[model samples]
Target: MLNKKKELYVAVAVGLIALGGAAVFASQSSSGDNAAKDKKPPASLTSVTISDQQATHIEVVPVKTYDFVEQNEAVGYIDFNQDATVQVFTPYQGRIRQVFVKAGDDVRKGQALFSVDSPDLVTAESTLISTAGLTKLTTAALERAKKMLETQTAAQKDVDQATADQQTADANFRAARDAVRIFGKSDADIDRLLQTRKVDGELTVNSPLTGKVTARNAAPGLLTQPGNAPAPVTVSDLSTVWMVASVSETDLPRMKMGQSVSVAVMAYPGKIFQGKVNNIGIAIDPATHRVGVRSEIKDPEHLLHPQMLATYRIRVADPVQSAAAPLNALVREGDGTMTAYVTKDGRTFTRRAVQTGLEQEGNRQILSGLQPGEKIAADGAIFLSNMLSLQSR
Candidate 1:
């Protein structure tokens, strides 16, 4: 019975050893499978190739490092520099007797714009003439009184009264003359009115500065007055104009006074207007959350007109250091990854995913996934991508 029991125990120990060996083998097999699944495929294994004869048709260049500006684009419009614009009004109530200029006319300073028949001018001129006559009469009387006193034929009281009258007449004459001058009449015209004794009620309105007439309300026989509806005319100096732009809240941080800007107008395509930021608004619009930005552009050629649609690009940052690639070298893949083809030898070109930065002019900035000296397809990268796609299919 003792020998049979020992035999059973030996059989059970052998079975347990076999089971342990089998479990170790299965665990080793599973770990090997997982490592194979996690391994990434080599890019050279799937790289695209072309013959030397085909390579002559395509151009390749080394990736370059340079400084690039990050640009922010905004829509804007050409506007008048309010400081250089003027809305002219007549100085007195009157009827427009004649119109000498029209809208769109270039006018010089002191150029006659229109003439008005003013009753106020008539009243002022009449007072001036009366005062001139009275002053002349008082002066003659004063001279006679002085001569009589010198010969001891008149009392001192008589001379003193005459001198007082003369002084009073002079004060009245100056007041009347100034009133006529206030009605847009020059001092010389006032003198002529007094000298010729002519009562001229015609008042002429003149341009206050050199500019182009942008609006006109003057017409023959129209009743007009100072501060009436629509000024007599609007003149604007277009030598330097304002470009008003609304900047998004996201881009407001990029704007500052004196920042350089480039403007393009639909009126003259291909012509770029240069300007600088003159002002930035303190208030942000509630609805759009955009701040107002005003840039002053020199339009000495008068090529830009007010209210014209314009596009603005602002350079907000100093040029940044980055790897630059030709725009033609970049290819956007179906997976939305930006890629470029790189090659160590001319025959085998591998696909490399590159992170892109600012794209301006024709140059694109490569933020990552490319070295400075790596060779890339400069002109025909898209064609290579297409060929690779066909082969994969």
Candidate 2:
């Protein structure tokens, strides 16, 4: 039985060795297959070429030179030219009897705006009439007195008394006439008043020029005086509108009188009004440190009104030539600086720093740090940034 057990153990060991050998061979075969697979190149990396179909989809823009105008941008508010603003006030205390025009009404020169009731105006008118009547009567008396003195038919004392009476009447009449003239009353107006019974305080206010009424102070039945707290009305000529703007000190050197300017009002967007620089303020504001500029726009149709807010762009001659590039070519860095990619070859790009100037016509001005004819990556700059990030990682 011991011999049989030993033979059985040896047979078991042999079977175990055969199984171990088979397992080792299978492991080596699996490793060799893996090595062969690793030696083969990936399909994406080996001898790859873009297909004609893909090449047709690629787009490229050639670099070309273009004449561009450099412009400066600023924000400002609008104002009426002070010279065109007219403040109307009453010259005498009176009740407004009738208002011929209302606010926002257009008036012509010498047009009667409103009439007023005032005792002072009446008094002046009546006195003027009396003075003229007395002058005529005194002149006849003086003539008769002179005739009597020359003929010696009347007493000399009688003639002298007549002459003295005439002189006194003449002096009083002249004084009254002068008073009427000072009150803006015409001679014909005074004569008409003399024909009627004396009426106190009746006068009319008229517009001094053709303009639009911007403000109204004296309403019907309102009391007004010469030195009232506020002006009775305010009028402005709309034939020519004013665009007032404040320019920064840095840009003031480029501004000059008679330079062409274009203005846009918020009320009328998309419409451009053209004008010329009429005035430039000599003094700069201390608080804002800006200078005032005025442009005159022709408004024959009266579309523009006073006090309307507008933005003005003045075209001044640039002292030096500037470079410009497509807006998409620039990339802003995390540190607040901007960078652009310059194409060295068709496939490679180099990073370049650039300085910017005014943006006009959908292109940004490159003030410095970039030369013309340098091909810049106008598109896919973000892809380049991502590539750089991957390289860093």
Candidate 3:
């Protein structure tokens, strides 16, 4: 929007040209005294009088106070909210066995995205199977030894030795089961593996957060290691996003963190993404004298996309309470002055010169020449000004 400032001024100039207003006043001279006396309209240069019937065609509105805030704009692009964006990689060293999700796919927390064949997990499961067999065999031997001792066949030392071996085997089995659990196995999975004596090495990787997958680097047979990048996949929570722009360093003084911002992008015309200023750059660019301004925008609907050309307006000052006039009530004069037709009654309107601040919400802020409760011509103001100009000329 800031980039269109020049266009806005040109548009206003065109509008004024289209409306040829009355001359400020008629010039009187000795040579044209008779002509002026012969054909003078019943109106002064800054005032006009119309019939009652003509008043109905013109719209009149009262001036009132409106709250207005000053805002500055910066242009930038949309990006993922980095705080919620994450790189997904394998938790252990392995070869990817399956890729369940592709880029741009939505996933839920704990949902599986891929599986990998982890050699470490397979080794742990294999040890668990071996320990289970040794534990069972030792248990049977210890039972036999106890029975023999009771029958006066085995000595106490022999029974004790068998009991010690059984305990050691059981401890080894428990440790092996724990090692497999580290590979993201449940107790139920361990039990099933033990029952079938099957050693499965495939370890599934689940999404750490509920979001959309933005990038996928994992594929079948791809080798992966913990903390390696280009990550297996990139998932990001797009509930919020960043709008970063480099604005003039001079504007930095008025801008600060936590200021409210309204963003517009080319992708979505007329839709505003509301956000707040989250950061202001400390360093300034020596070439451009600009600093980075970042805002966090809420995108609960997820309509925003990364890299979209975005421009945001941030309020730089507190709102000012001032008299506001409807767009139709203010007219641009031929001499480049803004004028409003002030009326004491419906039929008589005085052309009062006005100073305007900013135009917003279909109203032109009345910086001067009008006050609250004053009535002015809100529509067809040009007709009055033109009629007076024609007769004066």
Which parts of model 2 are misplaced by more than 4 Å? 1-69, 154-175, 181-184, 197-200, 278-288, 318-393
Clashes per prediction? 0, 3, 1
Cα misplacement distance, residue 2 of candidate 2 (Å): 27
Q: Distance (Å) between predicted and true CA of 118, model 2?
A: 1.5
| Sequence-dependent TM-score of model 3 | 0.75
Q: Residues 16-73, candidate 2, lDDT per residue (tens digit)?
A: 9999999999999999999998896433211112234533432223333455554545
Per-residue C-alpha lDDT of model 3 across residues 1-393, encoded as one tens digit per residue: 876998999999987766634222233354378776788556547778898889989988899999988999889999999999989887789999999999999999989999999988889999999999999999999999999999999999999999999999999999998988887789999999999988899998889899999999998999999998789999999999999999998788899889999999888887888999999999999999999999999999999999999988999889999999998888888899999999978788888999999876687888889999998998779998887777666
Collision pairs in model 2: 118-201, 119-201, 122-201
In model 3, where do residues sit more than 4 Å from their true spots? 1-44, 49-60, 131-178, 343-348, 382-384
lDDT of each candidate versus the true structure: 0.90, 0.73, 0.90
Each model's TM-score, in the order given? 0.75, 0.63, 0.75
Ranking by TM-score: 1, 3, 2
Give the TM-score (vs. native) of candidate 1.
0.75
lDDT of 3 at 152: 94
